[model samples]
Target chain A: MAVDEVKLLGFWGSPFALRVEWALRLKGIEYEYVEEDLSNKSLMLLQYNPWYKKVPVLVHNGKPIVESLVIIEYIDETWKNHPLLPEDPFERATSRFWAKFVDDKFVPLIIKMSSSTREQKDKVAEEAREILKTLESCLNLNKPFYGGKIIGFMDIAVAWIGIWAPMLEKIIDVKLLNEEYMPLLNTWFSDVLEVLVIKECVPPLDELLAHYKDYYDRFMATKA
Target chain B: MAVDEVKLLGFWGSPFALRVEWALRLKGIEYEYVEEDLSNKSLMLLQYNPWYKKVPVLVHNGKPIVESLVIIEYIDETWKNHPLLPEDPFERATSRFWAKFVDDKFVPLIIKMSSSTREQKDKVAEEAREILKTLESCLNLNKPFYGGKIIGFMDIAVAWIGIWAPMLEKIIDVKLLNEEYMPLLNTWFSDVLEVLVIKECVPPLDELLAHYKDYYDRFMATKA
Candidate 1:
């Protein structure tokens, strides 16, 4: 049998890339991580993911798999131990649905919040709060994680909320995940952050804040 | 063991709904189809999918699974026969990546073309054509389907381009899928339409045309 060679092409500050890193760590898979410069992308990064030309591409052996959620699923399926997703088909579907919701609905709101002007920030934060409420309703307060006691797919998918949400709140001067309104989600946010795998993979807070601050400054400059 | 009870709540004009219908048909699964009125949604639809309140909700044994792609995956996993996804892990990821591309990138462009103004129509069509070229490059001219020889996940996910692209071109008065520019994709479109299950489930052309025409008129009126 051939040795399994796994390589991940990622950008340091990307939440999407961090999801892959967390999944790999949770599964205990040893792999190489190549950080790509988004400003001037590496040739291999472009070649591996020509379609999106984006990071979080997992190259196993010689073949490359793009898309973070897809790569996580790939890793889960390839390695049976420490399953990121549930075994039941229905539970798996639910996991996938929530993951999609995070990427499609929730993540975009955060990005919008990041780029919004002073006038637009309040409305964006309000809209984000509404989404957070919906997310809060779905959580099982009894369970420590979304996958019921284990840190699984949903935990990894929503890891951004744990790591980035607080930073975003500080950056935009808005409170989106108040415990009074979203108790379950607020608890889940804190619980997720404490997970050793997640804690280790999170980018340094000051560095991440600096990165987003720079991003915000650039956006404001463009608007001005 | 109790017999499987599958129910799909869908809207006829929605390509998202149509994908689910095609998947169930291809799997040879017995399912009850409930048509949703988007104007006044059913209580059951709202209760089942409170977050999105959209169609293509698959209720299996009373458990509702929203999101067409997620539902299709659930169906594929539950039923053993006529696999929609590839068996190999890498191949499954590839199928998923393309399915997502169809929804995320290609479908949105088509929807934009539908709602665009006369001035915006040509530019949207041009953009749609560029996407078609990328899709075309991925097809194997020798293979009949994106899954190769069989209508699988990718085919069902992209069924809209086969069924709706022609209508969209007529509706918008712009050419998007020229055989000269994208021979393989154009051929795949025809081939996918010819599949017995897909051909049977496609919405009546005259009705579909009227539906979209009314939609276009409403948008234009709003703009005016």
Candidate 2:
């Protein structure tokens, strides 16, 4: 017995939840996926993630782990099959650096989408551009994936947002990750999507956009 | 020869930079600390962290690790002495989770400090309260530190801002972490400060306040 009882509590419309699902699939690990309704969260999910009380909680042998990036790393460490991070410490540190970078920058971009004024949106746009530029420069364009041959933890951590950016641009009527403007990011996006696991794990663009729209509306309505 | 030539490039007033300093001191690792002027960052520092070009870049045995939290973890992993994270996977994940939680919440608080409008300040105040409540609830008051029996990675990671919350309250004229409001957080502040290494590493409160005031003024002036 491999202590193989694994389960995930997630929402289909959530990109954060998808990161964990994709990592589990990529590792060829079998587990149960319990779709969480955000409107009516399960008591188990709430109990497991009492701090944030949010989705994508992974329970392994009855122990719970929250936060998508944290869960991904946990999975990597627990099951050594199909290594997600590089063996080299320097490489691993570099990848984790970008993961934090992406996580930190996501906040302001979300605020921009919920901003009530044009000035605020413009300011956020500039902030978002700087973050995108940082990501662009850090990326190794010559590599087929973020990890060169295969997707790694950094790739999985950011893989969801890469899809969301273009869809968001479409909905907002303003481009964020334009191929003409960011040739490297554009190429990397295509390369990331080439992976069967990632492609399958991604929710449809239309559905993601709809979710973002609903979230934005709810956020703004609360403000009003 | 242990290949132990370690040098840290950092700015004097950055909390992020202080994280590495505190970790090194706690681990009893001797290293050179090179304070870089943020306005005129050293070429080596720039080259070492080209993407972010930010402070708290640690070079160990000639290899550079950027990002404060990332560098902290790298130092912990490489040293394998005076361990900052717990050995158990679940506990380690929990420590990392709180660290990430702290990192995530500071964004809005920083933004509020930099904003011009009272409305913006109010919005951030609400956000800050939510984060504080989470912290005050998640943390065990009886434990002297976040990691019981010792000041660990999560404590040092957030210690800079944790100490500054009172100073931040002084500036904004609001008491978010006062004993009257949050007895546990207030007590934890003194608890963390009781550590000799952490006590010595903290910059003077007056200097920190002065730096933030200068920054806040300039930021608002630019917006005007």
Clashes of each: 0, 0
Model 1: colliding residue pairs: none
Candidate 2 residue lDDT tens string, A74-140: 8988889989988777888988988877877765585566564767665676677677767777687
- Residue B153 shift from truth in candidate 1, angstroms: 0.5
Candidate 2: tens digits of C-alpha lDDT, residues B1-224: 56598999988788888889999998999999998998888899889987688988999888999988899888888787889987777778878888888877665576665573877676777778777777777676577777777888878876676767777777666556657777787677787887888888888889888887787778778888
Q: Residue B131 in candidate 1 has what lDDT?
A: 78
DockQ of each model vs. true complex: 0.94, 0.60
TM-score of each: 0.97, 0.82
Which candidate number maximizes lDDT?
A: 1
User: Which regions of candidate 1 deviate over 4 angstroms?
Assistant: B117-119
Q: After aligning candidate 1 to the native by TM-score, how far in Å is the CA of A58 from where it should be?
A: 0.9
For residue A1, model 1's alpha carbon misses the true position, in angstroms, by: 2.1
TM-score of 1: 0.97
